[model samples]
Structure formats: C-alpha cells, structure tokens
Target: MTDQPPPQDQPPTPPVPPGNPQPQYGYPQAPPPPAPPQPGYGYPTAPQHPYAQQPGYGYPAQPVTVVAGSGGDTRRGENRTIALIILAAVVAIGLIIGSGVWYAGSSHGGGGTAGPGGGKNGTATVTGGKEKVPANPAADVLFKVPQPKTEDPSVPTAGSWLSGRVYAKSGIAEIIGYDPADGTKKWTLKFPGPVCAATERVTADGRTGIVYQPSMPTKTSRPGCTQVAAIDVRAGTELWSKSIGTGEFATQFRNVTVSGNTVAVGGSDGGAAWDIGTGKVLWQPKPGDGCSDAGYGGGPKLVAVRKCGTYGNRTLSIQNVDPTSGKVISEYKMGAGIEYAGIVSTDPLVVGADAGHSASGGSGVSDYFSIDNRTGRLLARIPVSGDAYEGECDTISQVEECKGVVAGDGKLYLATKERNEKKAHGSTNEVVAFDLATGKQTGQRAAAGDSFALFPLRMDGGNLIAYKKPPYDKGGQIVSVDGASFRSTTLMELPAAGADRDLQTDFQPGYSEYRYTQGKFFMAEPNVGKPIGSFDKDRNLFVAFGTRD
Candidate 1:
C-alpha cells in the first residue's frame, strides 16, 4: 500500500493535543541537627563516645554517650534517670534512619503501595507466575521504533496486537511483527492502502480484522475504505482480503471486528458479516427499513448499534445477535435525541451516550445505560457528568472506540478528572466504580497519589489493571487493584531518568495505546502523521518497558 491524503470532501480530524509537562521534584535539604543537651550544675558531666554515622542519606553522625558515676548510693537515682534518657535518644535515632530509607525508595522507582487507603486483602499473590508484583519494581527500556515518514499527516496507523512472542504494530501501510524482548523485526504484512479502522479485540488464536482502501488516494481521486481483511498475527500473514459492492455505491466500512467464526464490518452504508475461515459472505444488511447498522462491538458476544429514522431525529437500537447467523437474540431501544451511542462492553451491555448533546469538554458521554443482554432489559441508567469523570467516545462512525473507562465484574470503572490537591502543589486523581445493576457509586476509590493520574486499562480476572502517569523526575507505573478490596500493587515501573523517562511519559493515556502483559508494558501511537514543523524529527511510533525480573 502507498501513503494517501484524505479526500477533499472528507477532511482529516486533528489528533488530541499533547499533555502538559509535569513539574520535576528535587530532594529536600536536610535540616540542622538538634542542639546538644544543655548542661546544668545538677547534671553529670556530659559523657562522650565515638560518633557513628547513620546508614542512609541526609543523616548526621549520631553520638553515643555513656554516663559513669563515681559517687555512691546517693547518685543511684540520677544514674537511672540518665540511662532512660539515653535509651530514648537511641530509639529515636533508629526510627529517623528507617524513615530516611523509605523516603529515598519512594522517590526513586522503588516498589511502594498506592491507593486512597489500605485494604483487607493484604498483598496480592502471584498466580501462574504471570504479572507478579516486584519487591522493588523497576523497568528498563526494551526498544523503541521511530515514526515512519509520511507527507500526509492524516494517514491512519491504528492497530497493534501481541501474539505469542511477537508484537505486531501497524505502520504507514504495513503491519510488522517484532520480537517482544528485543527490537528485531520478525515479519511484515503489507497492505494496498493505509489501515482506516482496526479492532483491539483479537481472536483466541491471534486473528484480527482491519479496514483499508484498495489503492492510494491522490489530489484528484480518493478511494473509499472498501477492503476488509483478516490477519493471523501469530503467523505474521494475511488470512484473506475481500470487498463488497462496486463503484460509488460500494459499501465503505467504518469499523471491523471479529466475533466467534464471523468477521463483521459496519458503517453508515450498512453492515455485513462473513465467515472468518473461508472469507465467504454470510449476510448483509436487509432493506425495507430506514435503519442501518452503525457499528458493532465484538468480544465474547457481538452487539450491533442500529440507527433508524430521519436525520436530526434518530433512534438507536442495541441488539445482541448471533455472530454466524446475524440473528438478533435480544434488543433494547435507546430513547430519542441520542444521535450516537458507544458500546463500553458487549457481554455486560453497557452503552455511553451524550443525551441532547449536554456533555461538556467533548467527552461524548453524558450518561451510561446498563442493560441485561440476555433479556434486553434496562437495568440502570447511570448519569456521568463530563466535568467530573474522564471518559471519551468518538462521535464519528467508530462505535466501539471508547477510552478512559473499563467495564467488568458487573461494574463500570471510570477515572475522575485530574484536579489540584488541596494540600499539595501537584495534581491527583482516582478510579471510582459504579455498580452496573444498581447504577450507583460503589464507594470504592483507588487513588493515584499526588502528582500522578490513574486510568483503567483492562480487567484481569476480577482485578483492574491501571496505568499511573508519573510525575516529572519519575517513571510511569502499571498497577493491579484487587477487585474485592481495592488494594493496588505495583506490577512494573518505567525508567526514572534519562532519554527513557522522556519517551515513557510522552505516550499519554487516552491518546495512545497501552498494553501490559506478563511484566512488559507497551505504548504505541494509534495514529502517526507528519510533524507540524520542520524541527520535529524525534517523534516515536512505539516504546516498550519491562521489569528486570
């Protein structure tokens, strides 16, 4: 495939702006030592011993004194009192040294507990030797890939998958698989055009779907996204490629996904399904009704978002359908005035929408509806204000593209907007959960300590995997919060200084792809384009960090 500029009629959407730089922290100056105990006439002459230095940073040498009394029984009481005072001083010095070590560890990338409060679950235990929490968690840069050069700044490059020991990343017009540990290129799958849409969900066997145009677009001619292909990421090869319709009436898919044995693609034109193994068309959108499938959410189950009615006045129906037959098993109709709805999950049947376009800050979500997929019953309508929570949904044709929110374990987890702390100079945030059945806050909050912001990545069994955007002078961290107790354990920490630290913090949440498996954390740009200026040659496409275990 060749690089192409977007058509004149369809302008490219600008990417999200980079995040503000965080303030760096420096070690505090040590305070002066306490004045030596004042001597009095009643007090015995100050006894002095050799001074011994503390074992940590910023601590002054401590003096150990021995009190000797030549006076007889009358001085016994005074001797006893002096001994007690000396003992107290020794204990205090030990505590100060211990505290110093802890502070130093936390400032660096040492393993430290994080959250709003402690939990009853205690420390998490490693299961199957995967995702083990390190005692002093720290990660080293595994590799980085520079952004591919492109004249057009709007070329889509949004796809990545980790299969077996290989990491496959979408480039300008190709998918390349690289060694997960090193930066060696394993294989490449070339496409005829840039990838327009890609699904994050991969089949159990490492197969995924993507939509692209058949040829490159030029100044005068631009092609529609009519090609759909299934790739076996594990094998680093394309399984099959196909398209539908012809000429101007051809269906241009906006998104693609895989569910069971079916590869589904949808758009404003309509929806269609095909067999994954054979690439044979299974079903197409039926006519007679004004409704059309806007998009689909695929994983475990396939749910379609069907839009009907005339423009400016539309209704949406959420359908749980059989993947192979395209049969609607259950349906829930959304209220009018909701022009678009994004699916947060297919199994739990959670939908997010901006009702009446009331959402602010362009989050594209004003509320969430939790439905029972089996019976098509609305369990609860949870109101989420854009001003308080940080969740995003694409207002375009991508229905399953949402960020900053994760739904699992019968709960919807959302990250709160970052805010300045009342007692500190840096900012902080928290991840709060809402009960899907009741549509109420669970009162459980996992905090991202001062100077850090937390965003939910995905769920691991019952736990929630979260990414902690680090403050300046520190490295980003991956944490796992216990589902039952809300306790967080650090799984991996990135570099704290040098070029690695700069690269690690460059990929901000909500704007980049973050994947953590085993003990490795991968961050890649979802879309890459030409830099705005001539001096922006240092742009990167992908960076990986892994624990030193």
Candidate 2:
C-alpha cells in the first residue's frame, strides 16, 4: 500500500481508521505488524509524508518553445542583453523558487544533430561481476530494507555506495552493508551521531570519506559536524577517524570528498585535507584577506571554489589545486554578481551558476561555464535556463552534488523538461547534448517514447546510461544510449505488476539515489522521515531488483 500527502494548497486528510486492510505489493502474504516505534528526534505533531511528489523540482505543467541557436561563441553584446532579461524577470517575479516546468533552448544554435556512426560500444563494468545487456531483459525483487523509525520528520541519512559484493546504506547513526544477491546483513558500522555529509565517489581501493558529529544532539546541547573519517566499504571497517580542535573552536564542515589519497572537507570554517592512509593533516585553512575556500570537488581531479569580498559584492575564483601540496595549478575568475558556483566536472572543469540571480526554479543554474582547466582560459559559456532543463545542484555549500546532468566525452548531456505529447495522451521527454568546445547543441537526441521521462544516470565508456520513468501501470527501464549515434539499448526491465512495481515507482529519480551494476538495480532513499500513520509503517528504506531470480 502507498500513502500520498495532500497538495501544498490543500489541508491534509485524516488518517485511515485501524483494521482497514492495506494492499501489500510484491509480498505474497500480508506484511508483518509494525515494529515498535524507535526512539529518535523529529517533531511531536502529526507526521508529514515524504513520498508525495513536490511541485518545484520535477516536471512542469506546460511546455514552452526552445530558443534557436547556431552553435559557437555568443557575442558580448548578445550576452549582455540575455543577462539583462534574466535580471528583469527575477525582479518582476520576486525570485520564485520551486520545481516548475519551463522550456529552454540555446538561442545560438538549432536543435541537436546526430553524430557519425562507428562510435564505441557501451559496457557495464562492475567490481566483482560483468553485466551484459540481455536479449530479453526482465527483473525480480532481490531484497528490501524496512524504514527505520524516527520521531522527527527530517533526519539526515544522505549516503550510499556499492563496493565489491556489498551494498552499503546509511541510517540514523549507523551504516549497514548487505549481500547484493540476497537481503542478508553482512556488517554494520555505527557512529556517535548522524552522518552530516558524504561523498558519492569511492576510491580504487574501496575507501570513502564521511563527516559526522562527535556525539548525538540533545535538547540542551547540539554538536557540530566536526569529525571526518575514512571507511573501507568492502571490508566494513574504519581505517582512520580524526578531527581538529574541539568545543567552540572546532572547524565545522558542510561537505566532504575523496580525491586520490586525500580526504578533503570544507565549509564556513574554510577548508582542510587529510591523508587517507595515515590520517595525517595535509593542510589547514589560512585566515586572511577576507577570502576563504567554500568547498572542493573531487573525482579524477581536485578543484576548489574560493569566495572573497564583502557580503553582496563578491568575486569567485575556480582553482585547480594539487591534492598533496595544496598548490593552485590554474585559476579562472568569474564575472561580477555571480555569488555562488557549483562544480559539475573537474577534468573538463564545468561550472554552473545563476548570474544576477536570474534562475526561477530551484535548479541553481542559469548558465554553464566550460573552462580550460590546464590554462585557466574560457572555452564556452553554455546558457541553460532552469525552465527548459532538468538538472539540479546545491548552490549553497555542497559544491559537487549536481544531478540530472552528465559531462563526458567532450560534451554535456541534459534531459529536457517533460512535455505533453501532441498526438499521444501521456507526456514524454528527450535527452540532448551540447558541445563543450562550441557551446552548440549537437543535434543528437534520445527520445523517451510515449509516457516516459528520460534522465541521464552516468557515463559507461563512451555510452550514456539513463533511466526511463514508467507510467502509472508500467515498470521502469534502464537503457544504454550510444554516445555518438544516439541509439538506445535496453539493459534491464523490472516487473510491471506486484510489489516490485510499487517499490520502483515509489523512489523517483531526482529524489532518490540509484545504482545499477552487475545486472542489479538498487534504489535507496537519501533521507527517511517519520511514517504518516500505521499504514505507512512498512515503507522500505531501500529496495533491490535483479535480472536473475
């Protein structure tokens, strides 16, 4: 059974009476009785349902026309005119922020065009196994972890990763690893308090970094996120746990990432790094010049977003730094009025920013700046309106957590906002590419068929791995799109009926974390809230689907 909250404009309905038989998905028999409510913090009033689709972040209602473009460098005068229009719109609307639909297209280029054939074939590379695209793809329920109880509605549970044969997930104050094939528990790592932040990347040797508090929060005392630790996901053990300072003088971190052998973290207290293997402090923040490091982006390379200047009048410098020596190799200074910038990719050095606060929706993007990281030279500035594109980023502190967009193979792949079909009844969407060098649409697009919305998951070699959200009665699909030819090959398909469909549809792409590997698809909630009522007590924290029985 599923529980949906009322729309924001309406009042919530009364809870269902007891003794009503709720339909159970996937499970052949009735679900077991609700577990005794666990002791945790949250709210004392009625619970807020977390599964209901919110308005501001996903598909919009009506579709607008995309702007036409020719693909190349946009003239300076044209750029100034576009910026003025965006600023005027924000002023007129008073900075509207939510998940709303809007159509977007580059004014410098026409629609995307297909590339040449003979592109590289896609492959699914897993640590312990190989996942090949099956001729007739089908999947079944592999396992499900029951949701942990909490009194508060908004608790932090923002970390998950797959290592070797174990799938690790975060809970209130603990991390649990489970067997990938079955639902049996492999190991558990407990923490003193809730996990404040986590990196989505894992090292080649199966090590990852996380930030947490030294102790649990209480009514009279609240602890800061000051501790950093490196854990072995495959072995389910902590390699090292350390922190600098204590009490009020300690440095509090809002983000953490693993780059090579360095575990870097940063926030309002500035930035710091530690050796992953020895737990030695590599460098500490130097206070002066009214400048501080906001955060760092890791994976393949290390890039820092440094902020300097007074309140409203500030400048940002994107710096490519060495992980061991903390030396800046190259730097790119952004234009005025751009307060915050999110790192999309380090190697290609793609940055997303809302110039003059022109972005309407909560996507935290108005234009993409592609730069030459080695030379610190500007490559191309790609304008992506939030109204038309479906990418997201944390414009505040977490610099590297962008989603719904992929940067690979010298191009940027983005999913267009879902629009109603002209000939069909349901809505559909498409994936388009942009050249990082010319800032022009590639003219190649991968259609999502009727009634499905496509989202880019990750890059597989030269191919693009994407997820297709199914309609009300159909199961979701995973397909691999050729990077050059734009052809899609079905990799796996879940069951359309029973409990599997219920679990699949419950975890949407933008709001949940998905990992597909070795013919298995894993969906886990980034955070868990208090159950709305007894009917929702059986909601799972995570669910796994596999091609094999």
Candidate 3:
C-alpha cells in the first residue's frame, strides 16, 4: 500500500532547487548476501554453536621453540601453523553467513528444528509450512488467517514472495514476511519510524525487495518525503537509499510503484523515476510541463496527465511516454469535464474517464473509450450509469464499493447497478461485457447472487476477480467470473476477522487494502489506529491466498 511519505520526528530538510540534483546513496555491488532473520516474526531463530562457547585460545597453542628444532624445519613448522589459523578463520566466517541464510530461509512451509544460535538468545522460534493455499482457485480452500494490519486502513498494502515466503507491508513502520503455506510470520523489518510509501518487486530469481520512504509527512511547514530507500526482502539489508527532493507538495505523489526496471514516485509537480537495480535517477520532468504527473501503464509506457487553458475552457492532456527516457510517445487530449482518466490496458489502448460534475450538477456516469495507441484516434466508447457510476452507494457509508470499469481480454467489463426490489448491503448489479473493437454489448451478463456486491479487483488466470458481501453476511466472498461466458463461481470465502458490526454507523467494511500482485494475493483489515509500544506484536488477522503446489 502507498501514500505520500509520512512525517519524521526530526526536523525537515530543505528542498533542493529545481535544477540541482540530490546525491545518490548505494551499497557495494554484491549478489546481496541473504538477509539476517529477526526475532519473533515467524522466522527460525539462530542456534548456539558449540564453537562459540569454547575458550579464546586456538588449538591450545603448543610451544615451538626455533632453537629446539632443526633450523629449516622450524621455519616450515611456523608457516604451517599460520596457514592453519587462516583456514580456521575462513571456516568460521562461512559458518556465520550460512547460519544467517539458514534462519532466513528455513521457514518455507517445511518443518524446521532449532539450530546452533537459537536456544538462549531471545530470537524467534519458528515452525514453517503451517499455513497453505491451494494452487488452483477452484480447489477447496486457499487459506484463511488473521489479517495483517496497518494503522491507517486507507493506506494500500503490497505483497511479494522472497525465499519462498510472503513479504507484505500491512502496518505502518513495518514490512512483514509471512509463510504462505499457512499464514505465519516469517520475518519482519521494522523501520525507525512509520513508513509513508512502500512497494515490493520480485526479481528474476523470485527474490523480492521493497522500496519505501520512511515517515516524513508532507503537511508540516517543511514538507517533503525526502528519504527513499530499498531493502532486501530475504534479509532486510539496506540495498540502497537516497534523499530525492519531492518538493513541497509531496503528498500529491502516489505510492511508490515498481514497474519493470524502474521504481517511480508521482507528484503534481512532475515526479522522479529511478533504476531499480541501482539508486540512479533515470528521469524527472520539469514542473509545469504539459505532462507533470505520471502513472505506470502496462508494458513500457507511462500515462502522464496535465491540465492547461483558461478557467472557462480547460483541457487535459493524457500522454503516454517511454518510461526509460521520459520521452512522450503518444498524446490524447480531452475537455476538462472528464475526471479519473487512466490507461487501463495496453494492447487495445483503452482509457477510462469519469465526469463527477457536469454543467448541470453531477453527471452520474463513467466512460470507457479505446483509442489507437500510436495515433490517439478514438476507436470505441462505452458508458456506464446508475449508483455505480455515481461512485457507488454513499460517501460515508461502510459498504463495499464497486470498481466500475475493468479492462481484460480485449473487452471492457463495466459493473452497473441493477434496479431490483431486494435491497441489502453491496450492489445487486449486472456486469456487462463490451467488445473492445465495436463497443457493442456481448449480450452476456455475469451471474450474480441476490447478495452480490460489486468490486472488480483484477484479471486473474484470465478471469475477473470480483468481490461480494451481502448484508449481515459472515464474511466477504471472492468470485472468479469467466470473462467470456459471464459465469461467476465462488472461489473462496474471506473470513470475518476484523469486520465491524452492521450497527448502521459502524457498518462500512474498510477492508479495501487487499492486493493481487504478480501471482500472490493478500488482504487484511486494520487492527489498531496507533501502534502500542515496540510495534512488534499486535493481534491482527490476515490471509494469504495462492495457487497450490
């Protein structure tokens, strides 16, 4: 999950003037040695080795007098002793690194025993493989566990897998790794303060690392989310960190996101992009440029938005750029009324836009249109109306909101509110699919139960992952809807862990912090508003769902 970086307890750093660049920070190039396992986060503790308890004296130094032995023999004997000491030192160092690697990786859904460094030290005692999810969504149960929590439920939670463990940031100030086999703590990396923005990315080896900015709130007189850092997921090692000046209005930037080889920070005044492998600033657009703010689209493109013209007649330019060089590749312009315009898919060059307020008050509709990716010519348009288009249900209500438009499989799926006599919590809506090429309804509607609430999450295994929760239901249910047939099947039922009672005022389920990245899925609810004490332990419920092995 992400936001503008949070404020720090220390004083604010001055802003770096527009042209001057900030210094970059990076660690030595190594194959990133494994992360050292921390205590009590569901990782195995290091065991006490037998050699550690031995006396300092090595090999009980035997007295070898040069005078007592033959002259040539004495020199050779002394050389052999020195060589032996060096060999022992090398072996000892290897053992230490090996022990750290073992503790870091020993908890991947398999039983592990306490090893050399675990006993007396207050390190965490871990048992792995307890929690597991089926490889297929059609199976019995993926998994149900306590939700990992964050102080602010509004903040997004991002997930990744490292060393066969699930690493996620569910709470502020901490990024945790869980054993997906069963939801158990694998390891946790606690920041010095709360984190404002955090994101995780998996590399080729399946190892994931998180790039985050520590708590440096932007509301203060000296506003900035100055420090951006990356840590290894397996061992929490600070891979690299740097203070890139986010200017004054840092909160405008969205969560730190890693798309491909670049990790980007968004802001109204033109954000910055950095190479994920190295802490090098790849590019940053000058503020007031036609396209200032940017978000990642699929493939190698980035969507950039900027506003121009006078108050009476305003124009919004949405441009697609080459992320590696920040060069504008294609541009599309539309009038001011269209809001929330974003590129939803790459192959079809589809864009979604909504107009919350029209000339005659608010227009209760959201539009989706496809354009030629290269020429920016409008190809097709699809509009959805009803309560769903008005941003779903109510502003202050605790009901699950519907994600109106989702693009998948060369078609645009729109969730519209259906006028039905039965009214409960969640939307009784029909999801209609439109052919991307012609904008005509396919005449297929996804089967929705009487209690179906609308929230299309993402495209999973060629199916759209939808969310449903009936009034007074035990827990939310995740449905896998076939994009072609419009058939909906209940995949798994989310447990009612941190759900609030439906006592009118307290009924809105704020569990929107769930995420599906790569192949891993994790969702959790907020436990505590502010962490108590060490930020180590808090009773929270979270579940990790994945395909069965």
Candidate 4:
C-alpha cells in the first residue's frame, strides 16, 4: 500500500544558503535587561542583539524593522531594553531604601528593639510574638530604704509580709512598724522577750499575718509550749494574742498559718484555727499529739504536720475547719514517718514531707522532704544537709535529700549537702532541679557564685528559685533561687553576722519575695558576739534596727 518516491541526487544549491543569512525578521533580538544581577547573563560573543553590528557611541537600540511581505512583522531587536533599565532602577531604589532603614535601626539601638535585659536584638529577622520581659541593673523599683523618724532606728524586728507588712520582734525585745520605704520607723510595739535565731515564726494569709512565739521545753512535767498572735493587715493592728498551750510545750511555738480569714497554729496536743479578727478559736482538734508545724490550704481547710510518736512517726492530719463557724468539717490521716511533716499545699495536690522512723533519738532525720499537698502522697525525696535545710528521699540512697525547693511547676529543685568524702575536711554543695511528676533530673543544677554554700528554701510555682547562705561566715546572705534561672547581677555585702531568721515564703505558687530587705546573712559567731538585732524584708524595704544609743 506504500508508494515509492524517486531518490534525488545531492544538490549544490545548499552552499548558497550559507551566504548572508537574510536579516532575521521577527526574531528575539534584545538581550535580557542588562542581563540582570544574575549569575550567567552576558552579551553573547559577536552579540545576539542587532546593535552588535552597529558602530555607535553606545550600542544603538537593535534596529527594529518592518517587513512589508509579512505585513509589519517586528524585527524585535533590543526593544525591551529601556523597560528593563527602568524596572531595575525601581528595584534598586527599593533595596537601597530598605538597607538604609536597616542600618539606621542598627546604629541607633534603644528603639525598644533590644531590651537592656532578657534577650533581644534590633532587626529580629524573625521572632515569635513574645514581647519579652526586660531586666534592670537596679532592683530599686521594688527596693527602697525605710528612713528613721523616731529616736534614730532602735529595734530591728524580723520584717515579714503577712496580709500586709509586719516587723516581728527585735533585740532588747520589741516589735515595731518599719516603713516599707526607706526602712523608716513607722510605729513601735514592744514584745515580751529576747527572740532567738529564726525564733519568730510567722504564718501569713491573703488578708492577715500571724506571728508565733515558740516555747523552749523545760525539764518539768512538760517540755515547752507556743503562744500565738494575729495581726490584721488592712487595719494595721494586732487582732489577738493567746497562749496556745501550757506545760513543757509552753514557751514552744508552732508554725502559724493563715488562709482566707482564719489563722492557725499547732502543738503536740492538737491544732487550732481562729477567726481573722475576733481571735475566737475557729477549729481546735484535740488529741493531735507530737504536732509541730501546721498550715492551711486557703479557705476553711487546714493540715498539721504531726509528730505522732517518739520514734518519728509522722502523720498528715487533714482537717476541714469552718472559718465562719469554727466547725470541723472533715478529718483524715495521710501517712506515717513524717519529718518536719507539714503539708506542701497547692490545693488539690498536697505535697508534704517527714522523717519516716528513727531507730533511736538524739534527734536526726533522713532529710527534709515534701508530700502531695492533697493526698499526702510521697513525691521525689532529695537528701538535705544540715538541719539547716530539709531532707528528702533515701529510699535508694542516703545521699537523697529534698533540698532545692520546687515551684508550682511540679519542678523540684533539690540541694544536697555532704562532707565531701574526697576531702573529708571540705564540703560539697549540689543543687539539682527535678521534675516532681516524673522524678527525673531536669539536668539543671546551681551552685555558688563563688566557692560557697547553697541553701535552698521552699519553692513557689512556675517562677522562682531558692538557696541558702553559707554558715560560719561573718555576714552571709540566703539565696532563694526559684526563677527558671535566677541570677542576681548585684549582691550587696552584708553588714553583720547573725542567722537570717525572719526570711520566709507564704506557701503559694509563682509568689516572689520582692526582696525589699534581708535578714542577717550569717548567724552570730561563737566566741565573738554580733549585733543584737534581726531584720525583715517588707514590700521593698528592710525593716531593721540597732540602738541609737
């Protein structure tokens, strides 16, 4: 079905086609706009633009021609060259302006672009929508010195913040009001006796603060007991003062805690809560023996750290006391073998700690520890060093002490102290942050800025860190490291050497001390005596004292 075509001999006419290829018509004659700022764009050798053949001052626009036969077909030669130049100029100008703006921002800094603190740069390039918190070299916004209005500053009470500001007893024995600004003397109320080191225990609520006077056990039928006093912050006055116990427990003071409108203190006999203003005993539970420190989860709930027996049988006595009616709504026991067995309360989840059991009794505990605030359940237990700080878990090893305090983040910061076995004469300080929910190390630990000791106090919540001051030093400062990474740019040299007694926290989460004042960094020296006073940190001021005489 295919037709055959005759084969033709090679024709010589093809040689004529090589001569003068007729001026290409309607062909792409223009090279790209100055070839752009691209990698491989340049005028081809011998040129593609028709202007390459033109002899002129500047390359003439490729000759545009019209072919009559084609009816105005373009001889497209460098036609778009002008357009390319203009476009590039516009882009160049835009880039130049942008670069100018960038340079200006970088040179002048202070446009709020870079915070003096925290972490930020000007241009940012790209940062999430976090405005970021800035820091100042000066903590002065929250720190002001209270000045003296009376006969020079006389009494330095351990200043504390309850519902409001309170300055506990000072030496020569007195409780006075120190201004939250300038450490000035606001008012003076004399107390009964000489306060001991960390002697004055205060329990604070949202609306009030209570101070307790602990009793030193005598060799009588009883050992010692504690007294209680409640102060109303808004009204600025002592609401009530009562002797909570008699016998040996007299002269003994328990942990005083206030939540909502009631204040509570505990003892070996039982624990009691009282009305905020009336001093009427709100709820008093009997047969609560060996009870030491106590606290309440806000509202009508109270939990006492009870030392149940002579052998370190600790118990979490959870009680619901009616602040309005002083009624015991509920009661329950949490565990046995509790040391310093108080409730680490944040509501719903109550974490507490205690010494499980002591074979004998010269008074030594496993370590300071904490429990679930609600269930009285055990959490991670870290080892504690001196009675200076609380200890925790030794279930697996004796080196476990719940030292570094945890904030509400369920992050427990534990500080471990041991007489460096390597250098028995020297000691080793370790602070580690652990996830309470998992009991695993967060892998972050803090030590001394210098070669010193780290004392950790209680933890708050998502924010804050706690640490301790080195003992035996003349004037030492206690550090509470709770912030994710708390770093103090400035730590002033302390003035005297005496134990920091009045420093404490209100037992809530994310709560910051505002560090307005400080207690004596170091306890008094053994042979040489130190100042006869203690200090307190109110809002932002240090309410302290010394004799004008």
- What is the TM-score of each predicted model, taking all chains together? 0.77, 0.78, 0.58, 0.48
- Model 4 per-residue lDDT at 431: 56
Q: What C-alpha lDDT do the candidate models reach, one value each?
A: 0.66, 0.66, 0.39, 0.31
Clashes of each: 1, 22, 35, 81
Cα error, residue 312 of model 1, in Å, equals 1.4
| Full-model lDDT, candidate 3 | 0.39
Q: How would you encode candidate 4's per-residue C-alpha lDDT over 436-521 as one tens digit per residue?
A: 65444455545443323444544333433233333333223333332354332112222233332222121111111223223221
What residue runs in model 3 are displaced by over 4 Å at the alpha carbon?
1-164, 198-223, 230-238, 246-252, 287-291, 298-301, 308-314, 336-340, 346-348, 359-365, 386-404, 418-427, 471-475, 494-511, 516-521, 525-549
For candidate 2, write residues 271-308 as lDDT tens digits. 77888888878766553335566788888888877766
Residue 106 lDDT, candidate 3, scale 0-100: 17
Residues 1-549, model 1: lDDT tens digits: 012112122112223221111111121222322323321111111111111111100111122222222211010111111111112011011110000000111332322354323321124563322455655567899999999987764567778788788898998779999999997998999987777778888888888898877776666766778888989888898889988767666668877888897788887666777778788776665433356677899988998877665444455667787787666677676665555677888878888876544554446666777888886777877766555667766544677877788888888888877777575346667787778898766767677776777888888877788888888877888887767667677777788898889897557787777888987788987766667676457878899887887
Ten residues in a row with the worst lDDT in model 2? Answer: 80-89
Task: Report the poorest 10 consecutive residues by lDDT, candidate 1.
Answer: 95-104
User: Which lDDT tens digits does candidate 3 get at residues 1-549?
Assistant: 001122212212222111111111111222322333322211111111111111000011111111111111100111111000000110010000000001111121111112222431122121211122223322122454433454432232333334445544445556676665565666776654344444333444333333334442233332334455555555545556655445443323333455556656543334566666677776653433332343444333444443332222223445555555555556555434332344555555666544333111011224455665565555666544332321221100010112345666766666544334233333354555667776666665553445444456656545676655443454455555655444454444434444321211121222234554433455553222333445324334344555333
lDDT of 1: 0.66
Candidate 3 deviation (Cα RMSD) = 25.2
